[model samples]
Target: MAEKPAWLKPHGRPWTRGPGRVVFENPWIEVTEFDAVAPTGRPAHYGLVGFKNHAIAVLPIHDDGCVTLVGQNRLPFADYSWEIPEGGGPLAVDPLDGARRELAEETGLEADHWREVLQAQLSNSVTDELAFGFIATGLRQAAGGHQMDATEDLAIARPPFREALRAALDGHLKDVLTLAMLLRAYHMAREGALPAALARAMLG
Candidate 1:
């Protein structure tokens, strides 16, 4: 585990975990049931979900301020979700390399510029699923079209950046990584981190 940054002061007492037993195991995730002592000194039973890969998300923004969106049916929630291109890469691999692969495989797009915008712990309460989000610009079509997974049936679209951001705010798109990346881009544009004309196109 990585150490916490030295700048911040420590707070309350931390929870101490005890012996654990595996309740479930799979290629993607593992659930371990453990006995722990909470910060309040109370005994608690907890189930920790561990992931085998890091989630990599890519927001492919075109020079014209258009963004690539992929829609697919998510079985867990039994709903169709529209999101930026995302997939999993092994924990031992570089996230940027994973992001590049995900972008090409899902949208058949290559980006000349890549900026990592966000790192988050998704559902940290029970799971340690960490995610990395990137902004990919200067986009162009890949030599071959998308090579979707055998089980994937993605619906692809290119909507203006503003419209996509609006969809996320309106609850039409609720993927965590997608929401964070879009808002990050908006902040970047407002702060002049992006080119003026490109920012204008996105803000429009």
Candidate 2:
């Protein structure tokens, strides 16, 4: 018997509803309108909806191999959640520039080295958004507090490599992006593909 190619398999649920973007304010993305048809063949109208947009996130590795985490206030949950340093605001910031800025703003550390790690798409039934993730190692302490905005009063934590991974597994680090990068960084560091500090932290 012949097996199908991995790509041939459906990766997501079949769209039962068809919602088309009715109006577009921005070319990259826009408020969308959807016509969701029911299983019984009845069609329904879905009005305006806020669309998702591209974003960049960083899992910063310090000189000692620890991953830097920021505790910040998230209005959605009305409480602070531990996530990777992230934010290009509501708009797209230059990829590298935004990654750099986020590293500094959230962690008060400047990276001497960085590289793009992964590019992923978040697909919902209605919309999909691209997210860029980066691996930042070789961190240097900043002279002043991280430049934080009103939504980002954060405190930085540098946890040991294994400790961080354990935290992530234990739900202390529940941020999806952070978990993705940590596992990626872990493999890279284990193979000595990462900078010395990162490798050391991963082994610890």
Candidate 3:
């Protein structure tokens, strides 16, 4: 086999940043406008939104090949969306804890096992929003029912993994985090990153 190429190192040049001013501020995000010199030495003004929290999402797969999904009205799109359990966690806190809480709050399901599956920047050019994805298995109902937020009127669904994957591929599930995580789970099943039985159940 040919030797793998060595990892590349960063160029390590910092952009020349000018003073930045806040354009808008809310509880969840802050938009700032700044002047900067780009790597190509062009003067530019940039507007970026910074999130107050990191996004967390959990994919809860039960032993029976079913996954939990939550449905709610999303304000930005003014449409109802079905997605895997997701929430925001303060940047200073552990994201895994946020995943656990969101899973319980949205679906009243608790997982006995948890694994961090993916991390990605969400729209890096527009917002400094980071996301964490987790795989949760060995699920059971919480002692009490869902503890949803006051603003949330969520509907819960438990569907076979294959059905959910189809919906995601068909664009019925538009949430970026949900799409990414579900595809990651499928990749895991195909690549043998998951247990044989569990992978079979998920892919089937």
lDDT of 3 by residue, 1-204 (tens): 356567754565567869999989999999999999888888999998999999999999988788999999999989999999999999999999999999999999999999999999999878999999999999998987799989999998999999999999999999999999999999998999988999999887
Name the top lDDT candidate: 1
Tens-digit lDDT track of model 1 for 25-50: 99999999999999999999999999
lDDT of 2 by residue, 104-133 (tens): 777788877888987876555445556788
Least lDDT summed over 10 consecutive residues: which range in candidate 1? 1-10
**What's the lDDT for residue 17 in model 3?**
69
Comparison by TM-score, 1 against 2, better one? 1
The pairs that clash in candidate 1 are none
Runs of candidate 1 with Cα error greater than 4 angstroms are 1-8
Residue 129 lDDT in candidate 1: 95
With candidate 2 superimposed using the best TM-score fit, by how many Å does residue 106's alpha carbon deviate from the native? 1.8
What ranges in model 3 sit over 4 Å off? 1-14
Clash number by candidate, in order: 0, 1, 0
Q: Is candidate 1 or candidate 2 better by lDDT?
A: 1
